[model samples]
Target: MSKIIDLIKAKEEGSKPFISIEFFPPRTADGVKNLYARMDRMKESINPLFSDVTWGAGGSTAELTLDIAEQLSTTGHVANMHMTCTNLEKGGDPKAAVRGALETAKKNGINNIVALRGDPAAGQEEWKAADGGFTCALDLVEYMTENFGSEFGISVAGYPEGHPNAISEVEDPSSMSEAEKARSSMEGGKVYTCRDADYKKEMDYLKKKIDAGADFIITQMFFDTKVFGTFVKDCKTWGINCPVVPGLMCINAYAGFVKMTGFCKTRVPAELRAKMDSIKDDPDAVKAFGIEFGIQMCQDLTEIGVEVLHFYTLNLEKTTYGILKGLGYEVKGSAWARVGDQVKTANGVGVVKSIESDGSASIEFEGETPTATFKKEEYSKVF
Candidate 1:
């Protein structure tokens, strides 16, 4: 088993944040091929220490998720397999599905797992425990820890703003007064409904998960660094000491921004929303703004002692690379140029290399050279 805990601890001790990237299952063969090709391009620039592969709805892409995890593991990066209780059997029923998934991941050499209580399926009003499946994320974590031993580094989700399912109380009296009048002049009482998680409650939950054997906590994506800072403070105050890596998604297009925030229930700052809204009709301008905003956000986060910046690379290169460049980071091997080989440019010169169908590339630059092989898919941001 890989020493994910040690690596995390080392990062904590050194005061340097580690970086991880995430990718979802591809819907088509072409998409898969393109993602692999892009991964090759990004490898050198992003230099991610780990990568996460997400399971699809209802665990539809379980097998594919394992395959991708295994492939990423081969690149010398830790691959975290995502597992959800949405499809697992619970309540003393046969643990066939969960067992099989874990065994498959083990067979493929994936030692880390991120367990989630995934969103309900389409057309479903609410998520119900699967017949014989575990009831919640904590149950899944307990199972993995017991079954996989100490080799598995388990991760759970944290919501800085609060979980959408959590509820808060507010005063309303129009209907209350009539009900009170009929009930012998009873006093009014507030009702609780499903709402976002309260900040303090969220901190308590994180502490519980840590005590339950979660090695790390990866947060739902957010736009504001202040929110993350507050979350860190609350974690300390609540005595939850596990590593919390902030999730970041580089918004490259207005449509993508809308879709992602909607899916994650993340707040998009009004200033950013306005900027995106203004360029909704212009794809080029939107792309430029996305890169700039993402770069600035990254720089600010790093400056404020964020230990790691986890990027959701929706399998695109141009925007990701543009953000890296804007942040003054260069692609790994672009410094040395070779004779007769020229780097191409959409806006500026890039040490050029041809990408393959499988999404791998060997980049060779002109002039003086360094001893490194550049791949396109490895970078979240490349200069």
Candidate 2:
């Protein structure tokens, strides 16, 4: 099977835009079954350039993640497995399980991985480093490159606004209770944010990962296009050049949105937050707004020169389909399980801008400055 880096590179040959979707390993057998069916249907309909399966914190869902990844490969979908720096130690060797997982993926014909430092597992407030194991995603990237050479295509996570943990402390001199003042003086009540120095560290560390052989970056989700635009510019200023794919978090429910945004320390635009808060009580209304808002955000990203849009599908399809349909993509094919939509195109390849009533689509080619017309029969939708 082809690696994700190779596919991403393939997307540049013309003007076609691409998209990749991510799914987390489900906890139940039935959930897994449903996800497989959903993924199959999505592959046929949306034709995602590639799809990924997430590893649970501390490798809680390791075996199942591997199984699903293998299944994807067998079914001819290029699977990118997520591997975290947790639960990878045995007899004092930190790389035992990490190496095992990578080797297993290779044996299963999976050459793509998203190296992550992972969040804390269930009931844990902070991520604890495993003794003798890797400390962060940076270490994992370096280790993979050192051990595996060019055998695997690696992509690392980038926090466009800086990581949640990499924050600065602020001092407040406001009126406070005695205990509150004491706490403030100590490990205090000051809120953390990505300030100048912290953001510099984030940039520096990201460069290190790229230098360590990360082929591309997939950013943590952000609502503001300006933030993503600034990040792309700064990556150039920092001399870390590579394809930076935007991660889109599908707005599924009100409560889940609040919880995820709060946990990630993601900055929500005031208007968007208010929009969600207004419809917090009605599930259907909230979902409708999600699809509407998602359509707008995606259009903005595409206009801003974003190529491969990565959707955090959350293993659901309605919102994703709504957003794509709203963006003028002809959502087709069955809702039931099937496979075989793995055509990979190069970057900078012109995407079909318009589909005529008679089936001709406008596509930009290598020499064309303006998009030219092509028959729908002549060109394929690779995204």
Candidate 3:
């Protein structure tokens, strides 16, 4: 019943920071059931401001994404469904499938979407938009605004280190700017970064997405907190004045760290890399280091005034819990009913206008209220 953007804006200035979680569809039925259980437990423990379901490469998991999103929205989580441009079919209305997906999400009462230009299909070397179809995320944002109006709160991807396609190999790291050098990644003895020109284009494109009615941005993962801080300042320079949620990809294992950073060309601090290399052989040590490093990075982000810490859970939870607990957050109990929480009470359905120290909540019903105070037992969290 609540849009993700509304919930974000509803946060009082100087309030405690919140969390959001991202999940991908599991390949098996049993895997999905287990993921659902994990999500339910996560909600009860450390309630996230919103939950995200990724659209697989080439929209391969479209149906599953819709199903999971519906479940999350109906079960008291604000579901942010990712939609992409990879659903085009040959010689047909290129946006037919995309339109269908949007319709389904709206019908299911899911009001948030992450519009993206998705990764290419399996076995494809480069991404290509089908002829007569949308070419990029900007197009998708415009399409949604044109079709759905303000019915959905739309978000778009922001790459702190720039998109992988825009990042290119460089022989001379010496010539790169301080900002570029800090974000440079290495692969096969070569250094790579989004050159200044491409980084500007990325920023301009992001600004256009916002202009086209996208409500917020969820950034791609980066290890260095400075990289994210610089990106936020740069957004202001580019006139992108919206919430930019930093994506925190939890480092749970060494191999995943190596593989994903290499694949995305993500920047890793030299000391962080050396520490990981030293501890790579010890699984428990690697996980322990991940939590330790995550806490430090999160502390830096909080100092920079970020409102939300968005975790790419990768369908796992332990490391995330460890990091939150390290930060002195409660990781094992139900959160108090918050200002933006939607609830159904004996009086009627409404958002919580406020909450008392004793767990009493004031409910604000549509077209009705001198907001009424209700005890914890009189109302339950609603979709």
Highest-scoring model, lDDT: 3
By summed lDDT, which 10 consecutive residues of candidate 2 come out lowest?
Answer: 336-345
lDDT of each: 0.67, 0.77, 0.87
Total backbone clashes of candidate 2, pairs 3 or more residues apart or in separate chains: 19
Query: If scored against the real structure, what TM-score would every candidate get?
Result: 0.78, 0.81, 0.86
- Per-residue alpha-carbon lDDT of model 2 for 21-120, expressed as tens digits? 9998888999999888788768777888878899988778888999998887787678888999987533566578889889999998999999999988
Supply candidate 2's per-residue lDDT for 25. Answer: 88
Candidate 2 segments whose C-alpha is farther than 4 A from its true place = 12-16, 89-92, 168-192, 336-383
RMSD of 2: 10.7
In model 3, which regions exceed 4 Å deviation?
88-91, 333-383
Error of 2 at 292 (Å): 1.3
Candidate 3 local distance difference test against the native: 0.87
Scored by TM-score, the top model is 3
lDDT of 2 at 40: 75
- lDDT leaderboard ranking: 3, 2, 1
